[model samples]
Target: MMTFSPQLEQKFAKMLTAYPEGKKRSAVVPMLIYAQDEVGSITPELIDEVARRCEVTPLQVDEVVGYYSMLHRKPMGKFHVQVCTNISCLLVGGMELYEHACKKLGISHKQVTADGQISLEEVECMGACSWAPAVEINYDFHHHVTPEKLDQLIDGLRKAQ
Candidate 1:
């Protein structure tokens, strides 16, 4: 049987309680997030476990995962770096920033570092058009970033790991 940490179990319980009867499926997103935070990615076993807890089918859970950019099936590093390269950001050197990050980390998009400290991805709009060239390291958002700033951020994450 799949097991989550005690804290995650509590969080899942609390999340499920927030939904009314027959609406437990609404808890799928947060549950998957917590599970992924613990496991690094959305595994098939996690899909089935989340489905069973939410009273939904594994296919239903899989569909939810597919719909969200934040969800992933493959393993990622401890820090997942997402660079936005949407039109809004691209106009302001987002692609350049992404390339800089790739060169700095020596890894291409959707690839993890050898030590598994960081993973990089070029993503779509993060709804921060006003702050173009924004990047997300895990859950934290950094806006109006330059290559130098990204270097500091990534280096910090590496050290944190």
Candidate 2:
């Protein structure tokens, strides 16, 4: 059985209104974000509910989820730290910073902290090559991140939680 909290259903309804009468499918991305905002992750149950609400197939919703990097099929920590490991970032100490962060947390990239507060991942790019060695925690960007900066960023996120 699939269902959404009333608030989520309301959000979906409102988002659908923004599109043409038969174009509710156009709201898939934003609806997914709404679900993600409410549930913390884009679980399979949420996908089915989104599909049902949008009058689309579950496979269509799954495809949308897979195409978007921001969407997650599994649960993540409270703070998801995605470090850019692309060419520019790598040239600017991205690897070292990632390694240092992993060592500090005693977990590698794509692993969550034991406390379930932080999940670290190595990403290709964040479109901020000029700000090489950047990281995004919960989609908030931190540029020119060194090991010290990463530590400071983690500290701030931890405190906020």
lDDT string for model 1 (12-122, tens) is: 888999988889999999899889999889999999999999999999999999998778899988898999999999999999999999999999989999998899999
Query: Clash number for every model?
Result: 0, 0
Candidate 2, residue 139: lDDT: 68
Q: Which candidate is the best by TM-score?
A: 1
Off by over 4 Å in 1: none
User: In model 2, what is the error at residue 13, expressed in angstroms?
Assistant: 3.4
The 10-residue segment of model 1 with minimum total lDDT is 152-161
The Cα local distance difference test for each model comes to 0.92, 0.84
Query: Among these predicted structures, which one has the highest lDDT?
Result: 1
Estimate the TM-score of every prediction: 0.91, 0.86
TM-score (C-alpha, index-matched) for candidate 1: 0.91
Per-residue lDDT tens digits for candidate 2, residues 44-81, read 88888888878899999998898987788777788898
Residue 155 Cα positional deviation in candidate 1, in Å, after optimal superposition: 1.8
